[model samples]
Target: MGYGELIIRSYDPQYDRTRVEDFERKCEVGPAKRVFLFTDTLGDPICRIRNSPIYKMLVAELGNQLVGVIQGSIKLVTVHKPPNDLAKVGYILGLRVSSLYRRRGIGSSLVIKLEEWFIANDVDYAYMATEKDNKASVKLFVDRLSYVKFQTPTILVNPVSHRMSRISSNVELAKLKVEEAEAIYRKFMSSTEFFPIDIGNILRNKLSLGTWAAYPRGESWSGVPSSWAMLSVWNSGELFKLRLGNAPLSCLMYTKSSRLIEKLVPCVKLPCIPDFFRPFGFYFIYGVYREGPLSGKLVRTLCRFVHNMASKSKDCKVIVTEVGGSDTSRLHIPHWKSLSCPEDLWCIKALKNEKKNSLHELTKTPPTRALFVDPREV
Candidate 1:
């Protein structure tokens, strides 16, 4: 079926809000599995990248009908060097095409146009993420777009429960001031690939709940902890809501049964799961870092603390985070295997050449497992 001429143009919220939201509804994203995922942008299509320093939203229109949408954001990030050793990188996200427009080149056209914008802005590199099993995305970005395979991070999700986990009596957890958190991150995480240079802005943003640190009860330091771990929480729920689709019947039955039992007997927790079948919100754990002995244990304690805090919010259903595939810290975080994605694929491309003999040529080297996932990108 031939659709009329396709025109790619910048998205204007004033006139495109409803059509964009409608287009988004038809583009529930995920691999074709018994369990997939959907996102509701909560009225604004660009909510995800709204707070970014440089961002753009483009829409593909066929005969005045919006058929595709793509969002991109540019930021200065560390490429594993000194604090001043930063590169301008563009992130492509929320790429979507209408079901009726599939295979008609709308998706690819939108991406090409966005890349042109990135090039015009002097972006050094461009990257994007998708599910590891998404063959279509792989074909589009890798096979067609010539983007190279980059980092593979695992997304960990632990649902908040009525039951709160008790932290070890020997551990002490405290909230850090925004300045303290920024100092710690710059001192330690500057070497992490893609660590944001404007991390202080992220921590001080309204959406950030705060940063937390955990350590042995008796041990402490003036500016940093000797044996400790720290993480920051971003209220991702504020940007969008998620709903699980085509979930397995066994899982659904368990969820319903557990909730029913809990209603019948309030005292019996029954491990009742939240109703993910409907739209729900979640907290994203970012800026995850640790050091010293038993730091893995400290990471686990920090996750439990976040889970307990999330439980207090009626809308927060899960605590989620992403870490490098080889990071041992994953072993310490509490998350359900079924609810977590073990391999989230990231693809990268160099739009401009790096300095001669520069070790900062990000596309040429494999990522160190110590990755700093930008919460804004999530």
Candidate 2:
């Protein structure tokens, strides 16, 4: 059958089992495993894409034969803050065309159809992510769909090797309590656009794994301070772990699948600026502080804490983080590099409404500045 003969439809409960199974088979990766890892079904990851509420599942059928499938969702651009117009953005999650139908434009057709749905639902911009190594997929997004390069994130891997790298010591790294951490975070980020790190969100979302502060050890601060936090998920033999910590100065974040420490050691062994960069692990740092001595120390200690945690997980391979528009300097850390550019879902309609047409390039935007989008409503 031809592409036009195929049909793309919204998700139906009757097709959930079939769709999930087909996705598992087409990818040679189980949906259950993928969903679980992304959602931390057994628990919660520091940051999760699977937890988004607005998933739209689409399937392509040729006279009843399931030839391909694509999943997309509407999300609020949460990273951006106020004074910037708030808008709903669309993200294409899982787009799979069967191997036999590879050359066909099934994926493209699916995206167009998805865009229609997005437009009808009042979405202004659509985005999707593909592995850096997937040239074909990248071409599909860029050349065919007119989707500009949104973000380029470097994917790093660390293979599991020695025990020392996997375990965390009770060594008192930084002595600041939760309150102190929050205070430092707030002060440093006073000029930026970030959610006030409330203790409630942290407790409710379980966001406190790697948080450390610079305040005197015993002093109690009122709430969770505003500091950079790193989130991670580990996939290893008989163990899966998710961790989050407040980043002080500098940290490394990358993605991997397995044998994380061993694979990362080679990169660490390279001549680098900081001796602490010599560790094997895969995870991404969402943000890191570059100014102030206290903040710098906090960032370094947090990086070390995350490294130690990864050393313990046997199944993890990849770690990913979304860096801010202003903080490209962190990407220069010897062990770290630019994975992708900061591509966000911007609304031309909103800009036009506000009588502003031109916007700065992603690289030119300050890292601390962000446009916040709440995914729940999207």
Best by lDDT: 1
Per-residue lDDT tens digits for candidate 1, residues 1-378, read 666899999999899999998888767788767776788999999999998999999999888888899999999987745566778889999999888778988888999999999999998788999998999999999999978777899999898887888889988999999999999899888888888889988999999999999998877656556689999999999999989888889999999899888878888757767999899999999988889887999999999999899989989999999999888889999998878899999998878665323433555576675678988898
TM-score of each candidate structure, all chains considered together: 0.95, 0.58
TM-score of 1: 0.95
Error of 2 at 183 (Å): 9.0
Q: Which ranges in model 1 have alpha carbons more than 4 Å from their true place?
A: 223-226, 263-270, 353-361, 364-366
Candidate 2 per-residue lDDT, tens place, 1-378, comes to 344577878656465545545453335211222121211212311123333446676777777667776766665432244325445667676677877777778889998888888878877566665555456776787777766654443323223233333212322244344555455544544344333233223312333343433322233334433332322222221122332223223333332322354366755543222112222224443334443324334444455555556556544333333434344433432233332323432222121223222222432344443221222211
Model 2 earns a TM-score of 0.58
Number of the top candidate by TM-score? 1
lDDT, candidates in the order shown: 0.88, 0.44
Root-mean-square deviation of every model: 2.0, 9.8
